[model samples]
Target: MTAMHRMTLAELVGGLSAGDFSSSELTRHFLDRIAAHDAQLNSFITVTEEAAMAAARKADEARAAGNAGPLAGIPLAQKDIFNTKGVRTSCGSRMLDNYIAPYDARVIEGFNDAGAVMLGKTNMDEFAMGSSNETSWYGAVKNPWDTERVPGGSSGGSAAAVAARLAPAATGTDTGGSIRQPAALCGITGLKPTYGRVSRWGMIAFASSLDQAGPMAPSAEDCALLLQAMAGFDERDSTCMNEPVDDYSAGLTQPIDGLKIGLPKEYFTEGLDSAVEARVREALKHYESLGAELVEITLPNSHLSAPAYYVVAPAECSSNLSRFDGVRFGHRCDNPKDLEDMYCRSRGEGFGDEVKRRILVGAYALSAGYYDAYYLKAQQIRRLISNDFAEAFKQVDVIMGPTTPTPAFRLGEKADDPISMYLSDIYTIAVNLAGLPGMSVPVGTVDDLPVGLHIVGNYWSEARLLNIAHRLQMDTDWHKQIPEAFA
Candidate 1:
């Protein structure tokens, strides 16, 4: 039998249903794994052992009564960005370090209703600001592959937890490549569903228009299972679409024989690491061998994505974060001279440097005089980038590219250089700007570190994207490889 800790989410589900192992035993196996290995990875921010055990026991009882839900008894990790009722819902910042959520986010509610057990809250970048997990207030999460290297951000902790098998799968939110970037670095499967596909009522807002919750796991099948539970429309989140949720797992085995893959010339340009590009191209070749056609496409405004995102995201962030002032929830300053001082000191003391930088940039961009030149111009550029994808989709079923320019880098390597760190998400941000679904799957390794092949699909095409990724996994073993230390 496969070791409980090493099994994928789907396998665990089957094990539970077949009575191969009790949910309590499975939960304990993962909790033990987290205790034994997480010291080196810093993947988890909180461990809800008591709550998890109770849930697992209840799941076992429900199954005994023949009333088990689809994902009954499965243990999963939730990114701290999601508000879990009675749990510390810190978005990896001191400001909300003491804030306990009074209600669960829509995503959390979905998982709970599906009979999933929460292992704990995973760490993340402070307010989901930085590309590298270094911006996390709790400390940077280490890659399971190499302890000295980063596990990408702001969903780094979730990616590391799954890669290390601390949890079978974990929830992640991608505002601008947060899920996919870390998944690529950690060698796992991650999906950034179309904006509003998954409700964001309680997920901490970074860029309201771009933030999305998705799944991160070992295989596309596991992601399919998780996404089935996560996707739906909620009236609470106005931005959430009323579109019907598809059976994400049902289409995993669908044939993608005549699939048209778009190879963006812009993605193959300078600044891309040679080895990373090689792996992506090799993956493209594998798809070609599978009878999928590759076509050349262009996203001319892609070069402007970074610049535009910098303006638009921060502007939205500035507005969203304003509610964190001292008088309300989150960190409050002690010994304030006045109301103004309290507000200033609480925010200044609570926010990390990266968060502060973005807030300043956002405030400046949206300020009276600069609004037209910066914010508005960025919006226009964003529309052009979106239109680029709209036009390209007319010729292609999915867009293929490198998820990141390079594999994981040393932890402190880019900490001092924000610009370089921000560029880590260069290949991923445009998808968010265009409100499309994107995912990353492990194709191969470069220098013992994993590289991911990025797949972008038109809006609401998550089912096809999952099918394409699952087909590749069926024909390859990259997604099955685990880090040596963890293995």
Candidate 2:
């Protein structure tokens, strides 16, 4: 029999159903791996051993009684941004380091109801503000492929945990490229559903209109299973769509004979690395052999995505983070001269440098005199970017491109250069601005490090995207590759 730690989520489910192993045993196997290996990765913030054991035991009992849920007995990691009842929901900042959520977020509730065991909360960039996990208050998460290299952010901890086999699968949120970027850097599959596709009731907001929760795992098939439990309508969050959720796993085996793939000329421009582009182009050629047609498309406004995102995201972040003032439940200053002093000192002492930079930028952009010039102008540009995708979709079923300009870089490589770090998400930010679904699939490696092929689909087309990614995985072994140290 294959080792429990090496099995994918689906394989684990089959093992549990066949009575080859108890949920308690599988849970312990993962817990032991985390203890043995996490010292080198710094991926997890908390490990809920006692609670996880109790859940596993309950799942075993339910399975014996023939009342198991679809995902019963699976152990998964939750990103710390999601609120879990009685658990610390720090959005990776000292401000809320002591804040324990009184209720579960909608995503957490969905996973719990599906009978998944929460292994613990993974670390993340402080307030989900940076492109590399270096901005995390706890510390930067190390990439499993090479301990000296960084795992991408702000979902770097979740990505690192899954790649290292510390967890079978994990939950992640994407405000810009948080989920997909890290998954690409770590050589795993990640899916960022359309905006409002997954409820954000208790998710710590970075950009209210753009933030979304998704799944990260070993393959598109595993992501399909995880997404099935996550997608649904929730009245608690006003932004959540009332549209019906589709069975994400049901269409994984669907054929893509006449699929049209868009190759954006803009995504293949000068800044892209030669090696990375080669892998992406090769993957597109494989799709061509599968009878999928490739068409040339243009997103002319794509060059303006970074500037527009910088303005809009920070503006929304400033408004959302205002609730963390000292008078509230977060960190408060010890010595206070006055009410104003307390507010200033609390925020000054609590927030990290990257978070402070974004807050300042946001406040400036939304200030009285600059609001029309900066904020409004950024919004107009955002609309143009969205329209670019709308027009391209009329000519293609999905867009193909390189996920990042290069593979994982050494730790602290771009930490001093904020612009360079921000540009790390250049290819991914436009999708969020347009409210479309996007995913990253492992295509191949460059210099022993993994590269990802980016796929963008129209809104509510997650099922079709999964089918395409799954078909590619069937023809290649890239997604199954594991880091040597971890393996």
Candidate 3:
């Protein structure tokens, strides 16, 4: 109990079961930590003290009745993009400053039914648009490891909150690298499940086809427990897959021997930081020692990922974000010349710069004459990117690489250069483009910044990915490598 801050989800559940601590006590500890550190971290946009306490009380009642589940009473933070009933779900944008969802997201309902306590909503890039969380309307989230550096975005706040242990685990959406890159920078474990694996009905859309929600927790095993509660097909979401929920935790003991993991030559090429490559290679070496085999694979069109992603993601975003034109909820302008002025001034003042840039880019991509040259071409390339993953999967059980090209950079490092910021997600964007599952786990640290080892799995391969990560975690101390201050 003395090391409660570092305890994993399994450990916490077991401790709670044995009467070592009450759910309320555990929740208080996290809440206290948030209050103490969140000012500097800026991880949460809102903290639901009343709801969390009510849920904790109910969880204690369930435990007294001997009907508590493993996930019962666990306090979880959610990315602000998720619409939590009565909570301000801003998606880190000012446009939705007044928007209060009347209903919970499908994932939120799942967690609620499972008896998980809602801690609050974490910050993210505005509408999940930026790679570096600098685009958030609230403000940038600082990396827990290095306060001067960023926590990675659009899911930066989720990762930072988990890394700082403000909450045990949280939910995050990945459009490109939001979850994985932030998890990489924050030194926690994050997973973007296969597209359609989770319902997206109430999540604020970034890029409809590419955005997928997943878990960000202390480790992959925790992700399994969370995903167990947070995942399932929902009739409300057309894209949600109508499939049986697999026993993800049951596969934690599966053997990873003879697993063929592809290491894309493109990922290790120039522009990848030497320190990150070193640590990833070392992790891959450990995998090799476990009897897993590695092969150099070629994804010839990997370089086109950013351009293709920008084009396709923006086109989807422009259409999705049009709902925030001051009439339907959200923020309104102070004065309006007319209907057109109301829309223009509202959007012009409410949305941040990066958001406007994306809207313009996306609108142009989908515009009349240029649609064929940009949006259509991007869609075609997206198919090819997905095809690349499918082809690689035929010969490999999974793919491996560095989550981010480098550890979290200084907060303002890429703030001025959008292209450079986009490049930060180079390693992670393909998974979204291909609609494949991907994860980021801390494998090592470089210059005090934690290095994330990226794991890519084929369709519906989440359990397998977790198993591989668990084995590696058993043999390595990477997960134990917390930032010096937090430790």
Candidate 4:
């Protein structure tokens, strides 16, 4: 039998359901791996051993009672941004280091209701701000595929952990390209649910309008499994839609032959690395070989996404982060002249430099003098960006592109330039602006680092996207291949 640490989340769940393994046995296997390798990967910020074991025991009991679900005994990691009951939810910021949540985020509650075991919290960018995990207060999360490079962020730890087999399928939140970019760099499958599809009640706010949670795993089928449990509505999040959540896994077995796939004309343009473009183009041919039709589509306003998103996201963030003024919770200043001084000093000390920069940018953009020039203009651009998608979808079932411009670059390659790091999200950001669903599936690799094939669908096209991704996986060895370092 293969070692537990090398198996996919789907394989583990199947084994448990068939009585091939016990939850305790699987739980211990992951705990042992975490103890052994997490020191280098920094994939986890917290490991919930007691809670995991108790949940595993409960799963065993449920199986005894014939109450097993697809993920009954599966142990998975959570991004620290999620508020887990009695568990620390740091959002990778020092400000809330000691703050434990009194309640689980709606996504966490949904997963618990579905019988999945909680592995622990994974590290991420401070307030989900940076494209690389180096922005984390804890430390950078190393790519399991190439330790010398980054895993990608702000969902960096979630992707790295899944790639490293630290957990089966972990939860991640994307505001901009966090989930998709990390999944690409880490060589896994990750889906960003359509905005408002998943309740964000307990997720620590990054950019309230853009932040969305989803699943990351080794394969698209596995992403479907986890997404099934994490999505839905909560009255607490007014932005959460009351619409019905469909079974995301239903399309995993369906062939995508005859489906219309549009390739954005701009996605393959300048700034794209040759190797990455070649790999993604080949993946498209593979889909064509499977009978899917491909056509060229234009998103004329595509270049406007980074500029527009930078404005809108920071504006929302400035308002959301206003709560961290030292009086309520999180880090507090030592001795202060007055309450106002304490509030100012604590936030200055707790937030990272990048976060502060965004706050300042956001504050300025929303200020009366600059409102019409920046914030208002960005909102108009956002609508135009979304309109581009609406036009493209009218002619195709989905859109496909390279999840990123290149494979994971060496650590510090783009660390000094914030604009460079933001550009890494080019392929994934427009989907967020449109509030549509997007996914990243392992396609092939360049050199040793992983590359991802990006797939975007109209709102509620998750099932179709997963099905196409799974069928593509069936035809190739990409998803099955693990990093040589681990082997």
- lDDT top scorer: 1
Residue 191, model 1, lDDT: 99
User: Per-residue lDDT of 60-118 in model 1, one digit per residue for the tens?
Assistant: 99999999989999999999999999999999999999999999999999999999999
Comparison by lDDT, 1 against 3, better one = 1
Error of 3 at 397 (Å): 0.8
Q: Model 1 RMSD to the real structure?
A: 0.7
On TM-score, the stronger of 1 and 3 is: 1
Tell me the lDDT of model 1 at 229. 92
Q: Residue 153's C-alpha lDDT in candidate 3? A: 89
Q: Write the per-residue lDDT of candidate 2 for residues 1-487, one digit (tens) a residue.
A: 9888788888999999999999999999999989999999999988899999999999999999999988898999999999999988888999989899999999999898899999999999998888778988889999999999999999999999999989999999998899999999999999999998999999999999899999999999999999998998899889899878888888888889899999999999999999999999999999999999999999999999999999999999999999899886879989989999999999998899999999999999999999999999999999999999999999999999999999999999999999999999999999999999999999999998999999999999999999999999989988888898888
- In model 3, pairs of residues that clash are none
lDDT of 4 by residue, 1-487 (tens): 8887677777888788888889988988888878888887999999999999999999999999998776887899999999999999888999989888889999888888888899899999999998889899998889998898999999999999888787877999999999999999998899998999999998999888888999999898888888889777779999999778788777688877798999999998999999999999899999999999999999999999999999999999999999998887899989988989998999999999899989999999999889999999999999999999999999999999999998887789988899998999988888998999999998888987889999999997788888989999888877766676554
User: lDDT of each model, Cα atoms only?
Assistant: 0.94, 0.93, 0.90, 0.90
After superposing candidate 3, which stretches have Cα over 4 Å from the reference?
Answer: none
Model 4: weakest 10-residue lDDT segment is 478-487
- Regions of model 2 farther than 4 Å from truth: none
